[model samples]
Target chain A: MAYSDKVLDHYNNPRNVGSLDKADQNVGTGIVGAPECGDVMKLQIKVNDATGIIDEAKFKTFGCGSAIASSSLATEWLKGKTVDEAMAIKNTDIVNELSLPPVKIHCSVLAEDAIKAAINDYKAKGSTRKPAAGVEA
Target chain B: MRYYEALGLEPRLALDAGDLQKRFYDRSRQWHPDRFSTRPAAEQRTALEMTALINDAFRTLRDPAARAEYVLSENGLEASAQRGKDVPADLLEEVLELNMALEEADGAQVARSLGQFESMLAGVDGQLAGLFAAWDAAPSAGRLEPVRAALNRRKYIANLVRDARKTLETARET
Candidate 1:
């Protein structure tokens, strides 16, 4: 099947392809998979603690070109944005942007999952570590 | 949905491969997304995707070892990927020998190895069947982890054997 131009473009030149310092307080990492497609994706975000802003994002994915594109686009949307703003990124917007075929909709779902995973990771880790309390030794 | 529900089968341990194959073909002809290509574009697209899912599930369940692995996974257990490092020494030694022979075997030797491996696979499958029956009867969480690990081990070894057979077939064909 022919991939949409956007999918092909992202697949050819993927963006935000790397890993975050998972140790960082504001970092969120998401991992999701669909057994039907045998696809898995990991999305990570580094957020600025004081500002609650996303400073950077990265992702790793194992799947077809459409999955790659959706993730690439997600990270592109995530970077340089506040955590709240990033959370607002919608799967339907991605589906529209990529013009994903109905059969390929799962790719969009994976991307949305990555976004949520990254946010949850950041939240889980960020709230605990940020404002590091002085050790009353 | 339950696996049995997905396959439109009653939950049962033993199944007839020949009879199941006939049912599978009939289902494929009737409900496979490919048959809906001439329908609406949206419906066709849905059909195409569902067809792929059906095919994937069917292929996995049709094979004894793959089915075992999936059953293991359903219980939230996985065999170790670094099994060579993490597995018991005795198991490691056996796997190593099997792998080395598979790696070095000529096409004819590999074909012979495949027959031997099939018998071994059958043994593993029988063990898996017993394990599954036990799990179904008792449904013990305590047993699942270890059982899953063993099943995973079988799956990995089973996959390697299939890979070896494929390589041998390629060599013989060429």
Candidate 2:
């Protein structure tokens, strides 16, 4: 099947295709997969400890072109956004952005799930750590 | 759908190849369109439909993995494409590392990884066999969760192995 221009664009020049230090207390990691198609995606975020804003986002995906594109777009949208704003990012918006076919809609769902999982991980860890560098002790 | 019932046999995963073949042929004979040539239109249509269903059931039940999926579907547990998102963190970390090595490896390295992946898949298959037995001993929803989880892991391993094999094939060509 022919891929949409947006999908092809992202696939060829995928954004944020890397990993953060998963062991870092300040970094949140989200690893997701679709067993039916054997697609796995790992997305990570580093959050500003005090401001509650995402400082950086990265992703690595093993799947079809659409899956890769979906995750690439997700990371692009995640960076510099507040956790609440990131949470509001929905799979339907992603589907619309990529013009994903019905069959490939699950790829978008996976992306949204990875974003939420990462944010949740950040929240769980962000609570117990030292405050941001600029924050008062 | 009971694949065994569709073929008029008992529902057992350890079905004998000979018995399965015999049952399939016997069932086919009963639904053969040629035999229905003299029957009315509705009867002929029914025979054709039954024949198709029997063929599909036999094909699925003949393979271990496909048969397991069919059994899962029968128990109202449809395997979703999103099922692997919940794998344990440690396993996910290991798989990610393994994938990275595979992607960067050369011919010899890929060959070595193929062996490792095959062994890993074998271990998963062993686990699946145990789950299958567990399900057979007591076919309940509670037991099926582990079975489904095992199947999800197997799916991941299967894909990794497939990618490794493909890389090896390309290496050979070049």
Candidate 3:
């Protein structure tokens, strides 16, 4: 089946396609593998330490184009937001936004999951403030 | 039943594969269905069935684990299925507790727990393997299906844990 227009948009003009300084304590990085498909995704977020907001988000994905599009959309949704707000983001929304079919729905979910992993990595390392709102410093 | 019964000798399990292949080719020249395709219908059918039997026997003898399982099963020493169904209560408890933890966690928190869940999964895999071996050693067939069903449940639940982890990891992005 043909991809939805939104997925095509994200694929054609991917947002947040680069890396951030991984050494920053406030930044959490998530790298995940899809063993069944032998796919890999690297997602990163820079959270404001004091505010728990996401200042910048980026991704590097090595997989199908659907996966790449999903990551791009996810990064757009996450940037300039509080970590808590980002956490509230849903895979269903991504699917709806992309109008992904059942076969490619997993790609949207994968993107959502990559975001959560990055945030969780930050939380586990001990930043007490709940994820804040509006990522801009 | 004769190994050389091709020529009248016993088929040796330890025959080198290359030698076995050569011998099989030699026999096929005389007994192959390709040679009898234009012959009587009865002869063709017999040739087909014998060829199938020979190939089945060859494959069965080739794999060590399949051979062992076949031998034990034929001798009525197969592992009892019921032995695996009795999963320890503590393992069940652990599974339940982890499920509860994931249920209570938000997306970000659940992502944080994924690594731990992965390690837990490894342990579960080990337990399942041990149970399989133990059952194989038992003589009962009565509980085998139920035991396999329980193992399937564990596998299904493990997939859910993985799903939860994935949700936690990437929910924030979109």
Candidate 4:
């Protein structure tokens, strides 16, 4: 199948293609996979605690060109957005930007799911950590 | 179910390959187009269709993975319908780690890991066998759930193995 030029562009030069430290308290990691196609994607976001904004985003995906491009575009959109804004990002947005075909829509859905999972992970970590009571200046 | 009916067998996960082959051959002979050429046109068409179905059924049921997939589809658990929601967290982590390793590994490192990936594939196949037996012994939704999960894992590992092999081949050519 012919891939949209945008999809090929992101696939050839995927932005923010790397990893963030999963153990970091401020970093949220999302790992997801599509069983039907054996596609696996890992997207991570490092949120600025003080600004409540995502300062960095990284992703690694192993699948078809569409899957790679979806996650790559997702990371690009993720940076500079607050956690709330990131939550608003939808699969349809990715589909529209990438011009993904009907069959490849699931690739965009996977990216959306990764974003949610990462944010949830970040929130879970924040809630689990003890509050700084005595150390307050 | 048509595949099972074509082969004169019940819709079950586990099957005796030799018996299946025997049934296929017996049915193929019974419906062979050559034997129906003198019959009516409709009868000839039926013979041709039956032969085609038998051939397809044999090809699909002879392979363990294909057979399991057929059973799953028959039970309304299509592989393509599965999304990230059903994938276990640990399995995704392991697959991600393996992909990361493959990305960073040199030619020699990749070649070395090919063996590991093949062994992993074999291990998944063994797991599939056990799952198939479980479903055959006691047919239930619960029994088929693990079978689907195992098939997914098997597919992931198989893709990894294929990629690793392709990388090695490309290195050799270069």
TM-score of each: 0.54, 0.93, 0.44, 0.93
Better of 1 and 4 by lDDT: 4
How would the docking of model 3 be graded? incorrect
> Candidate 3's residue-wise lDDT over A1-137, tens digit each?
79878878877888888777767778787665442232446689998766567889988775567888888989988988998898998989888888888877667767777888888877776654444455542
TM-score of decoy 3: 0.44
Residue B168 displacement in candidate 3 (angstroms): 38
lDDT values, one for every candidate: 0.70, 0.85, 0.64, 0.93
Among residues 3 or more apart in sequence or in different chains, the pairs in candidate 1 whose N, CA or C atoms overlap within 3 Å are A28-A122
Question: For model 2, which pairs clash?
Answer: A34-B81
**Model 2 lDDT tens row, A27-78:** 8889887777878899999987677789999999989999999999999999
Q: On a 0 to 100 scale, what is the lDDT of residue A73 in model 4? A: 97
Which docking band does candidate 4 fall into?
A: medium
- The worst-scoring run of ten residues by lDDT in candidate 4 chain B lies at B95-104
| DockQ head-to-head 1 vs 2, winner | 2
Name the top lDDT candidate. 4
Of the candidates shown, which would achieve the greatest DockQ relative to the real structure?
Answer: 4
Q: Can you write out model 2's per-residue Cα lDDT over B1-174, one digit (the tens) per residue?
A: 557788987665455678888889999998999999999999999999999989998899887777888888777776773344566666666777888899999889999999998998999888878877877777788987787778777887888899999999988898
